[model samples]
Target: MAMEGYRGFLALLVSALLVGFLSVIFTLIWVLHYREGLGWDGTALEFNWHPVLVVTGFVFILGIAIIVYRLPWTWKCSKLLMKSIHAGLNTVAAILAIISLVAVFDFHNAKKIPNMYSLHSWVGLTAVILYILQLLLGFFVFLLPWAPLSLRALLMPIHVYSGLFIFGTVIATVLMGLTEKLIFALPSYSSLPPEGVFTNTLGLLILVFGALIFWIVTRPQWKRPKEPNSVLLQPNGGAPEGVESSMAMNFGNVDKSDSELNNEAAARKRNITLDEAGQRSTM
Candidate 1:
């Protein structure tokens, strides 16, 4: 009913879920269409690419994107350390995305599905390394105490956008790689055979992990405390009660000596004491 803390984390998580959901749906359609394989010869599937590689690369990119959603609230306290890590990771991810985009144009072949496998490989590897560093920094930020709030606000969007662009680039390049085979097939850089258990398992894990992170970030927090008012009814907003009546008492002793207030007698005594003090002073 009521909103709680960490709304941003929740929103990011929701976005990640959507990305992963769309990814699964897209992969399913492509795989079913190309049940045999993504070959040089065109088939029922319009794209001249392997559904498997596209699926793998898409999942990989999605993994980074989804993980970015989880990084923000990972440590709210140590903002400085967190910001530094976040900034570094964003820079790296952006570089990798741009490089991957470049490799897209370097497709070796046009007809047999371009296998700019080297570019994809290098970019993917670097992205994964940076993603891991980002994860470590997210955890590190939680432990720090002096980090600034403003820095966190600025860095979060950069991290998220870079991830989104990276995912987009991966999809585009994978399509190019699928449309035509590499111009010169390098034995070392070929894709693994489709239906490999390891690959499928990894994809499933990414899907599951992304879903979990999204669910966490988007989920609503507990109800916040209501503000207080000055009304004397119950401080807790409960009904007021009547006050008891008792006489206010003066606690002074009525029988005290009046001599203490006898100003004339006190003045005479002061004069006598002064006379005696004058004699003493002179002596």
Candidate 2:
């Protein structure tokens, strides 16, 4: 990113971290002060783990993973290292999500509360399961050596969409979970009790945090600029990777020998560019 963009990114980055950490702190207060301290035992304390882990792992770290590429400083990092970090953070999120799921079920079974009874549980579990699948696919396809660039490009859109989709879905599910917990635990929630108000505020913070991340991710200007050594920069020519990698692919080997192949390349490139430019101008 340019220096000017770096300043903007830095501002938003700090804002995101502040909100994210506030969420973590608020979750702690809610669980420890209101819901009782955390524990692995089959009790409400055990269920408390659900909210904490979800807030930290799914809402916070998972969000960071989603936008890691947008961090201007990390733009200098190797794409493979970035991929590893992305996969690592997501792994943590998935592990925490899975543990939270277990915590909920364990508490439910111990108290005979009935499992998968609420919309929160249903959707939350679905998100976790999907998240795990996403994590596995990302690690195996992106981080592993055997996956080809063609395969990566083909799946890139689906991968990107599913990631953001899951992130948004998890946030919505968290909101539902918070509300559900408040209703069950606080009979006076309708009156807007102190705990209820605080929890609602925390939810709002999380929602805003998500909005900021989406803004950072979706903005064309904030997308990561291609590094010099990026696969797209290779001589063979290929479409750039996700985020800021533009749809620049060599139609043919621009440096290749033979006039016939050269003509073909020129023809293809000219046709596509003119067509695309015309569409944009029309738009």
Number of the top candidate by TM-score? 2
Q: Least accurate stretch of 10 residues (summed lDDT) in model 1?
A: 242-251
Residue by residue across 116-162, what tens digits does model 1's lDDT show? 35664565555545555555544444235444444444454665565
What lDDT does each candidate get? 0.45, 0.86
Candidate 2: segments with Cα more than 4 A from true spot: 1-4, 232-283
In model 2, what are the clashing residue pairs, if there are any?
Answer: none
The TM-score between candidate 2 and the true structure equals 0.81
Report the C-alpha lDDT of model 2 over 1-283, residue by residue, as the tens digit. Answer: 4634777878888899899999999999988898879998898999999999999999999989988988777878888899999998999998899888899899999999988878988888889888888888898888997887777767778899999999999999999999999998999999999999999999999999999888878887888877765563222344344323332223234334466787999999999999999999999
Report clashes for each candidate as comma-separated counts. Answer: 16, 0
Best prediction by lDDT: 2
